[model samples]
Target chain A: MWKWLHPYAKGEATYRLLGAWLPWLAGSALVTLTVGLVWGMLFAPSDYQQGDSYRIIFIHVPSAMFSMGAYTAMAITALIALVWQIRTAEWAIAAIAPVGAVLTFIALFTGAVWGKPMWGTWWEWDARLTSQLILLFLYIGVLALYYAFTDARTGAKAASVLALVGVVNVPIIHFSVYWWNSLHQGATITKFEKPSMAPEMLIPLLISILGFALLTGALVCQRLRNEILKQEIHRPWVHAQLGVAEQER
Target chain B: MAFDSWYDFIDMGGYGFYVWLAYGVTLLALTILVMHGLRTRKQLQQQAVQQQQRQQRLARRKQQERGTA
Candidate 1:
């Protein structure tokens, strides 16, 4: 039943798989982001009321979406490491933390920037914003725990525990706007009602989201590959693989 | 060509700052991330090579000691 999973549980196999994925992910990210940015920034029509201010949504929305997604991914990896005691899973959890942290920062920063003009203040202790602030702290906590210990394995375990615990807050962050009538508007993209956006605006926004997702995937794969190589340096398979590349060096 | 002039593009109907700032920051962050990943991979590869060399040296020394004994 778990036969397919067994092969990839090993660091070497995981490293190779991620290696193959990195170029594809990176290439797709480059192309999509180029198209999305150009289309959204220039081609898309200005908003009716907010005019160009609403254009910020292309970046703000996607970063905010991925910030939550990356954390959820980290938590799942943490759970896998804990339950299955897979070293590769532990590495994955650690590899994702910094990337997730940066994405969360981007979300919060862009959110604040967008808020200034819309809300007439740089920031407010609104439910949605506050919950996102907590999310940033959670990302920091995981990274801090990772570096707190001397033993790599012990640090990974500790960080995984923190990541799993931090994941409990994700839902709270996501629902804060819905749970309360906060200043922050309810989700535009996810609402079941017909989208308020015109087709021109909607198309570019969707493209931006897809582009950001691809970039995130590429970054994660590359980082995970690095983590695997670092952790498995002492293993025979790693040395054998390096031997094959010795000529290139 | 999208707008009549630089000023018109910059005005963006008065939403220019918000729109451009968001896109600018997004581009900067993603570029930094990609560069960091590539740099980290190179550093890790270097460290792996060093570790392999150290292991090989230790193994050779042990073999020499055994031969002498």
Candidate 2:
């Protein structure tokens, strides 16, 4: 039943797998982001009311969405690492947290900027804004817990627990707009109902989201690889691997 | 292409500051992240080299002490 999981249990195997993925993800992210930004900025039809100001949605929505998604991913990885004692998963969780936190901050900052001209205020304690703010706090909490302990393994465990506890807020953040009468408008590109956007506008948005997701994956893999190398520095295989990398370079 | 002049592009129909700032900041952040990653990887490589040299020195010192004994 768990046969497939056995291969990745080894740090070397995990490192190799991530190394294979990083380049592909990085390439795809670059291509997709370029296409998305150029298309959205130049070709997409302007919003009837907001005009070109609405173009910020391309980056704003994707970053916001991925911020949430990355947190959820981190939480799940934390749970796996804790329950299964999987070191690779532990490294992955740590590697992902900072990136997720940055994305969350980006989302919040961009949201505030987008809100000012449209909503007549930079920010409000509305459902979406408030929940996003809470998300930022959760990210900070995980990061703070990560460094609070001296022992690496103990720190990872404590942070994992914190991440799991924070998982409860994910759904609340996702549903905040629906749960409250907020000044922030509800989901536009994310809804299951008919998309309220034209193809010209929607295409760039979808592309940007995909690009952001890929970029996140690339960053996570790079960070995870670094973590694995750091932890395995004393292992003979690590030195040999470094030697090979040096020769290749 | 849509804009008639530089001012029109900058105007963004009066939402210029918000729109451009959002894009500008996002790009700036991404650039910083990439540069940071590269710098960190270089730092890690240097640290690894220093650690290897320290280990080699320790081994040589142990050999010298054994010879004197």
Candidate 3:
């Protein structure tokens, strides 16, 4: 139950846990991404309509999905921090912000590149596009707010509040295409029924999605460890770890 | 494979520019983020080591002052 999570609430325990998970996350991410990208880019048949341009979906859909996923993770961590007063949860918010921001940027960029050939324009003010853009701003806002204050506690508190407020945007981004007549297409993988895509295309897309998720996991672990080090700099455990790290060097 | 030759693959059925650009940009951004994370972690550990050393020096000086006084 919740009891198992109790150990990870401690900074040192969480740090070790992330350390244990990093190699596995990184290795799987590498394997899946390579296989997925190669299969999607080369072997997958061209779309009957869009032809080879559809290959962008391999990266675009995964990045777009994980962008929202990262924000949702941040909101959960923020809730944990506020509700339980967990310092490690607070550090997780900082760990996730920039990665989510980058994912959002990738989504926007890839969507634009995909749009140019399909929609005849680089951008549109459609619901889906604009909502995702706002998501990018929200991530930046959380990051900016986290560092704006001189006091770390006050900064984390303010940033956690902002993250909680920003949770509202995740749903908006997901539903924007449906809520308004938009240029952006509806779901390909997340449809209520089976995916609209064929298995040839869909399989690699799913693999790429797994790759993106795992890569994000590895990146977050690295960032969380860094956050722990930064916050626990004056603690003896941090000093001992650093000394050991030096000896290993 | 979808393409018959190197040229055909590179062309990507005339959508090559868009496809490659998207992939290239995504790879570049992710690489930068990963590299930055690794570099920052090393720097922070170094900074922590320095801070620890400084604290040790300060403590030794305080102990010496108490002994002489």
Number of backbone collisions per candidate, in order? 0, 0, 0
| Model 3 residue B31 distance off true place after TM-score fit, in angstroms | 0.9
Using DockQ, rank the candidates from best to worst.
3, 1, 2
Q: Candidate 2 has what TM-score?
A: 0.93
Alpha carbon lDDT at B51, candidate 3: 80
The list of candidate 2 runs beyond 4 A from truth reads: A244-249, B61-69
Q: Residue-wise lDDT of candidate 3 within A1-249, one digit each (tens)?
A: 679989898888898899999999999999999999999999999999999999999999999999999999999999999999999999999999999999999999999999999999999998899999999999999999899999987888899999999999999988887888998888986646878899999999999999999999999999999999889888888888776343311
Query: Which digits, one per residue and each the tens of the lDDT, describe model 1 over residues A106-195?
Result: 888888888888889878998899989898899889888888889987888899999999898899988999898799998887667888
Model 1 DockQ (Cα-based): 0.57
Instruction: State which candidate has the highest TM-score.
Output: 3
lDDT of 2 by residue, A153-242 (tens): 898899899999998888988888889998877778655688888888999999999999999999888888888888887776666666
Q: 2 or 3: which has the higher TM-score? A: 3
Task: Give each model's whole-structure lDDT.
Answer: 0.83, 0.85, 0.92
Q: Where is model 3 more than 4 Å wrong at Cα?
A: A1-3, A244-249, B66-69
Off by over 4 Å in 1: A240-249, B66-69
Q: Each prediction's Cα RMSD?
A: 2.4, 2.7, 2.2
Q: Poorest 10 consecutive residues of model 3 chain B by lDDT?
A: B51-60
Q: List TM-score (chain A only) for every prediction.
A: 0.94, 0.95, 0.96
Q: After superposition, how far is residue B24 of candidate 1 from its true place, in Å?
A: 2.4
lDDT of 3 at A190: 68
lDDT of 1 at A133: 89
